[model samples]
Target chain A: MSIPLALASGTGRFYKHSAKIIRFARHGCTNRPFFHIVVMERRKAQHQPVIEQLGTYDPFPNEHEEHLVAFNFERIRYWLGNGAHLSTPVAELLGIAGLLPIHPRTYMTAWRNRRAAEEAAAKASESGADANKAPESKEGGSGTS
Target chain B: MSFGSNLRMFANKASLCCNVNKVTLELFSRCSTVAFLQYDKDPGPSFSNPDVQKLLKSMTRVQLEKVYKKRSVSDNTVEYKFMTSEQLEKQFRKAAERAEKLIQMPPIVKVKEDSQKVISRDPALTNFSNTKFVIADITYGVNSSDRKILVRQTDGTLEYAPLSIRKRINQIYFPHPGRKIRLPRMFEPEHLNRCLANFQYEFILDRACVQFDPYEKEYHEITTKVYNHINESKRFDDLRSTRHFGPMAFYFAWHQIIDDLLYDMIKQDYLKNGAELVALYYQLNGIDYDKSIHEKLETLVQPQSTIQSVLKPKASDDMHEEIKNAIGKSAEDFTADDISFEFIETFVKTKALKKVQLELALQALRETNDEKKKLYHGLKKAHGIS
Candidate 1:
């Protein structure tokens, strides 16, 4: 008989169709933890778990960094696909990790940077055009003479 | 004139200053004791008569000098600065020019009319009441003919107007029409309230933490204690009764955390939904609740132990080092946004998270990058960016 299994903080629930594993990664600052949950296969080991990453779970850590923890991502996705239910928080974490395939035009730091660069380039070209125009106007007058 | 006549004229002038009251003169004559009083060895005799004492008191050295100076000045020839005839004529001409300018100006006629008159004349003037229209200073004349009132405003501008009897009555009786006026709002109160609730909900969801208080009479308390015991061996401070460690403090701590969360949210999206929350909270609960209770709630719920541990310089040093390694730069090199600055200040001051100072510094560097990008875009727009 298959037994019910929940990983990480028990935020995952198992349903008849699939089991969802909420995986989180504590990656940012030492005491500041950021979590992401990923659904993976329950049969696999913790590190080499074969499944798609589902989501993240991050509990803000204390100063000593003793309680910092992270969850396996690949196994979480595998479980989610098979039939695993996620809680609200787990679902949100997964959405942020891009495992759920959200809106393509989501606001991201990289997009902002790209737009800023394009604007900067446009400004430089406009000024360049202005500078060139002044010289060209003077040349036109000289040619007329 | 004879020398005796001239001496008599001088004596008459001198006597004018020393003349006593007629009654006193008569009393002096009747009283042969006046000589004894005058020659009395004691000055006390003069004090017996209040009039004599008053005269003697008034004749001080300063008073005498003032009198002599007044006489001397009156007797001397006085000099005056007299203007020449041409100078007088020029001054008179300027005065005449100014007077002519003043006379040429029209008289101020206060239009003691009601709002009805003004409304009938100009519908736009209905915006105001108790209208006392001042006929312009250059108005040559004012007359009402065929229900039309003619007015010449200052600067030689003439206006043909109609009488507004309704406005005139309004001005004379009910001058204030504030009861009928209605104003438009940019955002409805209900809409604003909903927006605030949404922001508050998101903020709470993002930052709210559930911790097991050892003092709580629940199984969670025992589990938390066991967890703490297994995690570390440091002596924990018993903050059961402390004002900064209890439920109230926890509430306030959570409030501050949520405030920071909202700040981060707005920075990411530029939607001041948090401001709407604050406004709605005030509107529903009043300023007292927002300023006192809400503010206190944030302080009460804060995790003082974690803050205290983080703020400790020795404890924070290692954390700072780790942060530096992660970011690959010094925290001092970072520049933060206004919201981040406020968050850092509040978090450090209340929670005493000394390590956060380094985090703030790193965040500041990222903020600088953001600002530079924003500035570059702004400049590009000014240059007509495509």
Candidate 2:
């Protein structure tokens, strides 16, 4: 006779479909710690054994040297297809890596440009009325001109 | 007889100086007696008369002022005051030197031909280091519309800027130029300090204009020029690198750019009319509308007196009831606008609510408005509650 298999009975987390893509801190020989992009149960601790280690991120590598961030793109795409939500920093990293579409949060220069454009538009509309008045007054050389 | 006897006795007592030389001794005794009386603490027999004492007391203040002539006696000691002619002479000489160093500018409106002589290498201007030469004989060219503001740059070149730029800067610091920053009454230290303050403001404005002409299309070009100029010029570099002025360089740059950005908005006719757009602007900028600006905008829009007429009745009772109902209502039911938040803020502030009362009011009102959640949070933060 076969025993009935129960989901979440072993992990202590109730319900099915709990997955998170997180940056897990991993201590290295160097003074600074690096990160591991992993697929894990939502309830599991960061240092707990990950379901699958998909990538590595070395943020504090030697000066003038490019830091390494490598990942299994196929596994990432597969997990992403399975409705795995990307954390903000992880999404930013993935966006930079070209594995995912560009994240809006990471595009600060675009946001600044948009803001400057909006401001210019607002200023133009505002000054449109008074612009004629100022030039007129200046030309007239009226009181205190 | 008593007065005569007292005078004779005093004269005989002071007669020791007569032993030196008859004529010289006589003059010395007279002068010494007067000086002695001026510096003396105790009343001598000659000064014992009530009438004499009263007369001396009345005339002493006036006499003391003129008696010094060019000499200044320092009251360094508590009990005894002693100063020789040599010491007085030395003090007088130092004072003259100081007066000479402090170049007194003629009336700001008047153009003085002799100013050129006074401007060149004055001892007083030695303290200003580089700025002294520029400001010393600076000419003001007041034309029909636009006047040229000229000041000597660090590189011994006269840098020219527009009057409009100076006026804008003056408006920034001294909002009401006509009333405040009045012409100096006299060229004193305080006046000199005011001039220095103006110099700093003008210097910053001048540099900002050089760096970025807000109206011009060549923004990067102007900025690059300004950056290069500041770095290359010795005086500019000195100013930028100095501990005190280094931070102010950033401030000056930001001020110019921000002013350029805001100038169009502030000068708008629509904004000058009412508080609605001004309020929107403030909300956008995350700054509260200044009371003066608010009042000015209100007056410009309405063209009416701020005071409410006594004859006109107010709907304050209904307003109070509405506010009470708003306070009692749930967050989903009640909608709070900017005006409501402003009202609540003013209410809390005007009532001078206690810490506990303010917290209670905020807590009660927090549920009333979803839109003003950020504002309420700001209010809560201001009250020092997490």
lDDT of 2 at B78: 40
Candidate 2 Cα RMSD after full superposition onto the native fold (Å)? 40.2
lDDT of 2 by residue, B226-256 (tens): 3223322313322321222322222222111
For model 1, residues A1-145, the per-residue Cα lDDT tens digits are 2223334334433344444344343344666655434454444333433244433333542342211222234455446556665645555333333345322232232254445555666666667669777433322221110
Candidate with maximal lDDT: 2
List each candidate's DockQ score: 0.00, 0.00
Clashes of each: 67, 1
Docking class of 1: incorrect
Q: What TM-score is obtained by chain A of candidate 1?
A: 0.30
Quote each prediction's TM-score.
0.15, 0.19
Query: Can you write out model 1's per-residue Cα lDDT over B46-146, one digit (the tens) per residue?
Result: 22334322222211111111222222223566446689966755655554444323222111112222222221232222212122222211111222122
Stretches off by above 4 angstroms in model 2 are A1-16, A29-31, A61-64, A109-145, B1-386
Question: Which residue pairs come into collision in candidate 2?
Answer: B101-B124
